[model samples]
Target: MTSGDTTSGEGLLESLEHMGAAERAEHDAEVSAAVAPGREIAVGQGETLLAVDALTVRFGGLTALDDVTFDVRRGEILGLIGPNGAGKTTCFNIMTGVYRPTSGDIRLEGRSLARMKRYRIIQAGVARTFQNIRLFGAMTALENVVVGTDARHRTSIPGALLRLPRHRREEREAVEKAMALLEFVGIAHRAADPATALPYGDQRRLEIARALATEPKLLCLDEPAAGFSAAEKDALSELILKIRDDGYTVALVEHDMRVVLGVTDRIVVLDFGRKIADGLPDEVRRDPAVVAAYLGGTVEDAEDQEP
Candidate 1:
């Protein structure tokens, strides 16, 4: 054979070897993903459902969060609390993918959520309520909750427009589910009322109900007990525990010490954008650092370490 023919044969063999190596790499990746912890843990057996590692957020040199790190354990009520301007809401926003972190990482189960958008985050089994009451003012209470259930909907615009069999079935199911959620939150009687017409305490409950309609594994509530009476707070404490018992991992951000202590299995205290203490309710209550952070006293600062 001529020199050119020999060169062509050798080049074809090299190309085949490269293709085989690439195919093997792809096969290995598929096998790894099949055996990965994320695939198994997606069904919810891990100890930690949500984990934040060295989280920090900065708004033009104003550091809103400084290396905050914590985890929400599965099937427990975890309280995220601190004084005003302590970065609790910022942490909540980050956890819900409302704000991207300036550094560090967030993981759901073993899968990284660092690059997910707000809507994608919801699809990853997270839902949250705002600190300020937010509901569709013009919609009925049941309709507002139905909006939340829409997060789980897969119907296309064409299907919805055509009112196809699948779309009609899903619509009926969504309405039934929304009504069930309203009743669960003790507002079924007000289902036909405008969302804005509910009393302040009931409005808070409605927001929680709407969040629950999303069927999240992790529910983050921002100041849920705000503007509640003593009695309302008591009722809300029970509601939070009930949510936990219903197989949701609750991450609560609230100012009321009584509700926090009563409902939560553990508490993570934030001070000046840093976590000062984290432990069981009684342990955190007696922790000098937490006491100093809230009530203003001197306590030796413990080393800020990751959980």
Candidate 2:
């Protein structure tokens, strides 16, 4: 091998050595599972992880979502962008079982999600963070995250009431995993603080960590960069990319064109509750309908324009 190749290999090894043990282990497991015999990996390359099919929602005389359809591919960041009242959050609400669609359906990996409860949806490997901060005000950040981990625990309420050995064991594991998630989101130092006490940006990160604790197949984030400054938005963008690299499918809904264009693998645009464009960032930016209705001009104009 060339000397330069050896030096590059050494650099990669050093970086891997510094990688978080939990992250490394999780990624290795995903890789191994993908190649294992007779095992259909939960996350597969270029496969559809979520399918929103002809979803229509109506409240009284108004239609919130009119036959909206899209799919989030596994191991990719899909940006869902639109103007205000364009049914973005409504879509999120339906995906997470917060609202039942007036017509149409949502499926995860070919399983129809109709009639599923909110908790059932979470258990089905779909987790989300709200546009507004929804952290538990009285709970410490670690405790809040632990609650998410509990969603995946198998111990029954009866076992927990009796303080059974299995419950005790799972509780310990939950705390450890929660701490690792806090570290992953760059807020391990604030693990002991109340969630409400965190700075606005830190609070947002904490919400993301909690959602990650559920070990979701698809992570839906609604306007996570809504109130962030430019630097905070950049950090958040990196975190989103890290989440995707770690084998989580992300569907991001944001108003900021810069954030959407920078991190998304594909863009899905909605205008007046209808899909106007769905393609790569460049294609969506140049589409005349998207440019006029949402971008407000060319891509250059959209960079400084907020939808």
Candidate 3:
């Protein structure tokens, strides 16, 4: 090989070594940060990880959500479901700070999300997926996930332009973390492929991996199972539970009964901009109001059935 090739190879090895060191440091920082007072708002000791209290949203007389209230307990999956235009997405949007509430408030670990910007909400430990697939189609799966790791970027603009030591360190650390996230979401096999080249299901899993790259305390999924088949939905349910088990509080907005019933610890139902029910999956499933709203039939004395 040419001397130039040899030099490039050495540089690549150095970069990998630097990233390995940074990853170790990052792991330690994560442990310390989790227990650091003030840095962490202590969502663990609290009864709720997310609280949407009487949130109302309107767009020029179009009331999308009205006085919706619910709680997502720590390390649990809370399903938010309703029929078309039932304000499920609206509630999800407001909760993630995509849209401001017309009235009332939202809190994550007792920290009010009132009037917070979307990026600020993410930094405060909330991340969400879109109703539509939003992967960077032209980018590799790993690169797309690396975008989410920008939530932890600390390099100054000048440092990045100049390729300063700090900037190099941060970028390497981000790549390391992004690859780890891809493995966590079961997409490591496609890590080097263009995002658009993956199957639809893999794309969905990639989106979740991207969301996890931000290191969120609460992961909000908006209609994640919108287009999946029966088997895919079943797998998605297992993945959701695994996410919850991995120390995340998941809030799901899905229409698939397989996922809503099989995955969530609690389910909240909304109709006509109003919350009609909030309870365990079985209770919400059997509620006459929920059945009436979803099935469009007159209610009979429905008995509580287990999920």
Task: Name the candidate that leads on lDDT.
Answer: 2
lDDT per residue as tens, model 3, 1-307: 1111122323433454555565667664653333121223334633687888988899998999988888888767888888899999888788788788889999988999879999999999899999899987977787777788777778767777777898766666656666667777787778778899999999999999888888888889988988898888888888887777666778898877766888888888989989999898877877889988874554443343223
Superposed by TM-score, candidate 3 places the C-alpha of residue 257 at a distance from the truth, in angstroms, of: 1.0
Q: Flag the better candidate by TM-score, 2 or 3.
A: 2
How many residue pairs clash in each candidate at the backbone level? 0, 0, 0
lDDT of 1 by residue, 1-307 (tens): 1111122322322332454665646544543332121333324633888898999999998998999899988877899988999999999888888888899888988777777988888888889999899998877787777778777888877777777788766655555566667777788788778888889988998999888877787889999988888999999988887777666788999988888888888899999899999888877876887877874553333223111
lDDT of 2 by residue, 198-247 (tens): 99999999999989888788889999998899999999999998787767
lDDT of candidate 2 at residue 217, scale 0 to 100 = 85
When summed lDDT is taken over every stretch of 10 residues in candidate 2, the lowest stretch is 1-10
Candidate 1 local lDDT, residue 230: 91
Report the lDDT of model 2 for residue 289. 86
What are the lDDT scores of the predictions, listed in order?
Answer: 0.76, 0.80, 0.77
**Residue 236 in candidate 1, Cα distance off native in Å:** 0.7
lDDT of 2 at 202: 92
